[model samples]
Target chain A: MNQEEIIAVQQYENALSRVDQSVDKITVLMSSAQSLAQQGTQIMNCFAQLKREQQAYEAQFKELKLKLQSDLIKFQNIVKGAEARLDRHLDYIDKWTNLLLTRDLGTMDSQELQYQRNIMDAIQMANDNFNKELDKLYSL
Target chain B: MGKNKQVQKSSLTDEDLYTMLSDNLVELNEIELFFNGFLQEANVIDESFGTVTNIFNGLSMGVLASMNKSDNEKINRAKAKIALGTFVVGQVAKGVGSFYSYVKTLDRANDILVLKKEKAATWLDSLHRNYDRVLRSEISSRKILTHLASLGYQIDELISNREVYDVKKNLMQMALEQYRKARFNVFSMEFFIAECKAWLKNKHDSNMQQPILQDVNNSIIQEVLFQGDDYEEVIAEFFLGSNEISGSILFVLNDEQLLSHYLSTRKDPLIISDGVENKHINKRVLAIFKDNPALEMSNEFYEIRKEIDEDGEKSRKIFWRLIVTGSLLSTLVSFFNLYLFCRLVMAIDDNTAILSVLAIAALLAFGGLYAKFEEIYKELKNKISKNRENYERYYRYEFALKGGFANRRKKVEEVVGKSFFDRVGKAISSLFDVGDSDDHSFYYEKLIEREYWNPFFVTVSIMLILAIILTKLNLFFVGSLVVLLFAYLKMRMRKKYFYILTFIVVLCVVFLFLYMKGVI
Candidate 1:
């Protein structure tokens, strides 16, 4: 071969070497970008998870609030009913006590006395029942 | 040396022999390229302008070449002018041709856009659609439901009607929808009424020994004008907003005459003349006209009266309406221009030309829209300025009040917060308070729990339930109970059909809910 042929061959080899080095650098950069992209994707996924968790927490909080409201409503109804019943009983007791105390008892007999005792016992029993009912209500 | 001299002498022979072959080859290649370029340009020009430039160019050059000879004494100058005229005419033809071609390409691009529309829709809508889907995935809490309901409430007050924030846009849309239905029940009307009521109530309940009109200048004048309204003070504010007018009847008469002149010219009364009592006409007109003094002047007042009289033959409403109409027309023009722009961009196969044209068109369109809204923009801006001055006056008046009014306002807020428990307590104490929507619902719910059920009522209900259960075991008893219930219901509703309707409604609602829950 002549000198021109040898010089052309050398030039071609140098160009190939430069291209080979560039290819290696490009490969490294691509791999680094791929890793960064993977990390970015993971971060985005974590954010999505956090958003979902926040939604779940809000849902739970809402459910608890509703449950509490329902319970409160029910308890209030019971208390209201109990209060009405108590007021009725107390009003009757007040009238009965006033009547018994105010009544004239000069002509009392044994049968009447027995009847009075029975009435008193019955009244006491009613009072006890009312007290028991009120105690039971307060616990609830 | 003899051979060199002979070769030098014979060089022309060598060059001549070789030159003929190379020159022909190079010239043929160059000529082929040049002709191809010219042919392409001609084809584009012919396609775009439909032979306008191509045919017209030859005619124009011929005309110019003929016109140049012996036109004027400045023969050279005439020749130069002809050259310039020809160049300009040629360039214009080419430009028109290119634009036509560009517009055609833009139309083609529009067709492509139409084809790609669904795909673009998917990209733009997907995120918003996703957000909606996620938000709607669950059955919302009652509070959330209430919040959603309240979200559509009509805005009572806003500084600007059309100028909107992101949230305000949504609010205004809701408000406008409701206002369309409610009409007179608009937020502004409600706010005005409420403010008036509050002001009047404040006046009546005022702790101060002196009457409200005692301190203010011309208090009797205001009292005589705006009598018996709970919102007398609020009405007074409208009078006060005219920047402390001279209390003279002459000044008032002059002002009225000025306003009357404007109204006469406009051919419309500024005052609310309709439904006003006939007892006092002029006084009421004076009262209301003081609020809006714009009828006191016009753009015509700034210029020469003679010019204005000629121009003022037209209605003022028509003038503004014309501007609004012009804006609408400009919108149509912009839409057409957008269409043309698309066509233009499409015709340019080059990206650079397309981008440059797009930028230019967009800038023009935005600038044009700004110009269109200039009047309305100025009006709103002026309102803000006037409102600021009025607001300062209101603040000063409020601050100068009998000390406890602002404190009472704070107390009112506290009362609102504390009254709920008190109301519930009152419901328990008072039987009439039962079935009241707010207080009754609370007590009624509270009294019916299984654990603390009112023993007396509970026993009665339990006995009733047992009796019903025992009776229901027998078909005869069940039929009798149903008959009794039917009789009771009939006494009130007067029809057995009401029972069937109620049953059907309940069943339908239950079924609907179940179906919605996917419970079959």
Candidate 2:
């Protein structure tokens, strides 16, 4: 071909190539959009599963807290019952000692009453410790 | 000049070729400008691809499911394209529809641009909406042809109608896979937050009745699990109520406080607790503590502490064993010693083998009885009070020697330059003053007093007794006399030269005696 014809053919080819590349760019963008949407969906699902795991842990924590509170209450009640029985026995002893004063009667000593009081104190201390520990766990 | 120009023009085409060339060049320039704009757009998308892909993968399980869906779509599309290409190639080879196939290629190339125009616009709008700042700003200077003009002559040669059509088809097939891989980015914080929000929405939808509870749960879960720096809270919360919690907190909370708390407050003994949990905690604590030299020394400190504890327990047990059995056994052995000596004297006239057997049997019996008694005592002690601190004296002495835990910890911190063995050696050297000249002189003096004079006197007394006993029997033990003399010489001598001199004299005397008896 002549120089002018060659130049004209070259210009047309350049134009066509530019158009082809433009189409390729558009195609890339199209595919990119589809993938982005898919990725968004996938990421959302993974996050949901992780959230579910966290929820289960929270539920478990609540259940454990309730159980600890119940245990503390049960222990406190046991301590209170023992303390009441000791008080009732002390009352009975005080009432009967006066009736038997004329005869040689076996009597509960004041030391025995002190020992019983100490035992009650020890029980109360244990209950207090349990409550303190329960408080710390509840705060957690 | 006009006639010559007319002749030159007559040789060219009747078409306005120069004008047409100029117009086509202008079109080319515009197209180049548009192409560069698209490239810049692609570059921005490529950069965002990583961030988007990471956010998607991290936040969504749906990416994998979507990957499967897209992969199937790609496979089916590729198969259809391959079938169509095969049919076109077959028709062209048979010369049945060459023009038709050529037209079809051009149509297919055009379809990629025309068909996806609306889709591309929508996607571009979406890009702008989602990532406006991420998309690079357009270059204002209109330099159109520079980028594509530099793609080399072969690229220019290949940009013909047929080749362009072929290239477009290949580009489409390749672009899908690239896009799929570069689509999601779990690392993008914005996208990650959006994904978490989406998850919250989905979870709330499922439990619509308990939406408030779901929100609370999600918040608590996020706070507990995603503790960026304050990991101690996570561990503390994990072990709050359940003693039987699985896994370990060591990875999250590597603090010494956590380790010490775990160690001290363990419900079961270390021996009975789960081995895996213990191992994990142990490895993590050691690893963390190792970063500080002072803390690393605790490994040896704890070891020595444990040894000291075991020693105290052992000494106490032995003390009890001695009180219970050793005193009675010592008395029995003393009587037995006297009886055995008598038997030895008497058995000289009888079978010496029987004497040897009797001695071995007596020794074995004592050893066996002591061992059995110790075992019984240990079992009884264990049954009575397993956690008992019955031996005060032993513990007091041990603590006095080892110092308190605080003292040991201080010592570990202080002695950071030396190893455990080196520290122990230094301690022993200090006690003995082994490096001091005065200490050596004192040791030498003590050695001479105890080893030389004391043993010499004892040996002389034994020799006298033997001499008396052998004279009564009318039998002299020449070898025994020689051996006793040699022992006395060795004990008396302090210098090496004196020892050598005594050894020579002893050897000569022994040789002379042996020659006289014909026993050499």
Candidate 3:
């Protein structure tokens, strides 16, 4: 080849080499882009997992709160019932004591003994009820 | 020699020229594909960043809701830790995304730099100048023509029209335009990376010693979840050096108005109101002054602030003492009443006289206690109202000062219109009528001023009258039971329902009265 034709051939080779280098760089960039897309997908999955965990935790917490509130109400009701029973027992005892103070007993009489037995039975029943309530509260 | 060079240039055949131009065009197309790939990566990073922010917002809301909803300290701490962990994880994800973006941007920038240099070697004037037109016109036309050719259309005439379209020139233009766009994208990416770095730096600096994360956790636990006595100070300290105050912070603090005021006016001088002596609002004001040095504070205002703080401390002590004393007395009274009620019930079946005496005593005691309680409540209410009035006055004064002389004048006019002398005159006139000096006339005027025709007052008066009539008819126990039922309904039911019940009871009472009088 002549000098001008040789020069033209050399320039073409140089342009081809640059294009080769550009393709290599482009290939690397495309891979990096693919990796980023993968990373994005992973992040989305993680976000969904986190949301699910939060929802589960909230629902569990709400259930626990409701259980505790119901237990508290149950305990309160038991205490109130126990208190009313004790008051009734106290009133019965007061009446029995008043009867004893007023009635003079020289000997054991069936009528006074019956009245006393009835008062004692009522007091025993109240005691039994209070114990049952106490057992219920402790179980809770 | 020039003629020999021209002949040598023509020595290359048309086929060789077309092959070289087509090869260059293919390379340009590949580079354009890479640019598009880089752009898609950026979009991915953008979407991930958005998701991270969304996660952060969700975590913050969770922390706030958990703190507010739960009173259990352990649960609150656990929730706070979880929230902090999730936030840290989100931040990590964001950091990774940023790193990837930074790397890709640098890579793209380097590619564009090479293309810029290549412009000198090629026929293009400059890559940055011609890239856009080349990409839009030449590359787009090539794709469209190829698409049409694939659909069975012959476009050889269009392709061979060299005068209308030069292939090499179009490739050069496309490459240059793509280079320009890539360089612009690099510029934008670099700016975005810089912003990300700055944000990270700010976060690091703010979270250095007393990290906002830990502070928020502590505040949520101490102030919101537990409501510790020093909550005001805890909240104040939390906001002292905070650069970013989120909505969750305000929500947990439970005093959005106060915190928002502190934030909005942190740069300005502090204003202390008279009633602020009871609350620890001045601590937050001082915190503001500490955070922003540019804020101006007058010595007089500072002294007033100090004096008010001292007064607040003293009043807080007294308030606590009052609460303790009041609560103890109330508990004692309640126990006494409960005991008396039990005794009365026990005595009911045994001794009628004792029962009657005990019931009367209990009734008198309850009435006396209620009257005393009402008096104390009214006194406390009056004191609170007076303090509120003073606070409102000071608030208006502060507002006026901020709003300039025109507002100050307007406020002054308003104050003058409601002056103390005018209030005293109105009170005196309410007590005594000027039109009539008779004592009965004064009583009539007083009744009118009291609005005796008010529905509530009318209801109460009619109920009382019905109770007295029932008692006169020898249904004293029934009268007492009816009164108790009505009182319970009044306390427990809504006003509308209570009014309806009251109307029914009144109608029944009226019928009973008519029947007793033989008029029904």
Candidate 4:
């Protein structure tokens, strides 16, 4: 082939090579974009799942709080029951002291005196039980 | 004469050919001009790539969902890309950093050659970008070789286009040869351009990012369960995109040998990030920063500072442990001496004077405890002074980073777009002027508060003992000690105002006199 024909062929080859390179770069870029988009969508789903888990945790916390509140109320009821028992013991003491001071043997017969003594013993036992409960409350 | 007189005849084809040649030459010139601009922009891109990588690495892992089947790949890719970008940009930024670092130390860079040297560095970097772009491209090797071949021999010989390109070896040789020629201190514009082109061509071939096919096809997927690394804030923002991700970063171990980072989605997080083992924070930051010496040094400074801090803590603990031991010993000795004094009193011997000596020893022990607190305060003040002293060093590195050294240099130029530190200095000066409440004393106040509890209790215990001794000494001594103890209490009322002045005046006079005279 003549030199002119060779030169013509070489120029054509150079242009063809550049086109190939550009097309290759563009193709890679396009595919990368598509893959990236797909990945982004997947990430969104993961975030959605986390949001659900967070909501579940909040619900669990609320339930836990209620359980603790009920336990606290049970302690309060024990204290209230102890207070009522103490009030009855005080009432008996006040009434019996007045009877003893008045020297009313007729009003307080043997059976009545026995009944007052029994009530005093019961009050003493209740006071000891309340003290034990108080110890437990303080420890808690 | 008859041949010369004959006019040279031209075909229409010859005219067309001439026009095309003229057009091609003009196009070539335009291409060169366009290339210069693109190369500069690529430098900016290279810098951006680095900074973006740091941002991604620093991306909080809170953003990335817990590693599940989905969203893991996306996060992983982002992480890997950032790491890789930092590595490459680190390489580019170092050239600029070194030049600036050199500039600072060149107290006598007044010569024309020195300024010219900077110009040469600029030119080299400008061309380096072109080389990097070429390295990362997919242009045919033949095209490059063909252009290079034209630079060497006759046009006809190079244009023949029958040659197979031996690009790898040829590039290395060409670059080395240009460098050798450049050793003559030839700073000519043409020579500089040639050298840059040679460096670029040597570094990257016409074809870029080839698949890097290996003979051993070992592309097997192994599930890496990265536990204990946990989800970090930096990676929280990273999430999986599909089940597959791919990228790379550079990692180094033992302060040398930059490694090619390989990322894959099949593995767990830090499945790959665990490149550096047992990194101090500074070293870890440095690892991210790579060849940026300013950043490396900056990180290194912090590491050293932390080590110093740990050492200081260990020392303080040892000091306190000794004090507690001493306090207990003094208490025991005081009891033993008091027992001996009681026995001597019953016997009515002159040996009872030993109690006075024991009393003096107890007072000295109290003085020792007081000194320990003072030492702690003094050390704290020293810390303030030293850190303040270090302000210059930190600022220099800051300035170096903020100046025109590394990634920050380009960022400041882009974001702030002017002399950045000028405004920073102004703000700092204004802060100092406005904050006249003396923040320095705030730290001292905290020290006093911490020291107050121990020293106060010790003083009270000592004064009570002193009062007992005084009572035994016919009441006069007891009254004197009572007076002294009350005055000490009154002094503590204005403790913050008196920390420095009171310590210097009262402590020196009181502690030294008491210590030297054996009444402390």
Which one is best on TM-score?
Answer: 4
**TM, every model:** 0.16, 0.17, 0.18, 0.21
Cα deviation at B249, candidate 2, in Å, is 4.4
lDDT of 4 by residue, A1-120 (tens): 899999999999999977875665455345444544554554455445435544653464345445434534554556455445434533543443344334322221445433433333
Could you tell me the lDDT of residue B381 within candidate 1? Answer: 44
Scored against the true structure, residue B183 in model 4 reaches a CA lDDT of 17
The deviation in Å at residue B362 for candidate 4 is: 6.8
| Candidate 3, B336-361: lDDT as tens digits | 54445546654333344334343443
Error of 1 at B486 (Å): 92
**Model 1 misplacement above 4 A:** A1-25, A28-52, A55-59, A62-72, A75-140, B1-281, B284-520
Error of 2 at B225 (Å): 5.6
Worst lDDT window (10 residues) for model 4 chain B?
B213-222
Error of 3 at B365 (Å): 3.2
Q: Which ten residues in a row have the lowest lDDT in candidate 1 chain B?
A: B402-411
Of 2 and 4, the candidate ranking higher by lDDT? 4
- Model 3 achieves a DockQ score of 0.01
Enumerate the candidates' DockQ scores in order: 0.00, 0.01, 0.01, 0.00
Candidate 1 residue-wise lDDT, A1-140, digit = tens: 79999999999999997686566445534543454454455445544653554465346445544553454455456755665665565455444434433432211233443333333333333343344443334222
Once fitted onto the true fold, the runs of candidate 2 whose alpha carbons sit more than 4 angstroms away are: A1-140, B1-261, B264-305, B309-520
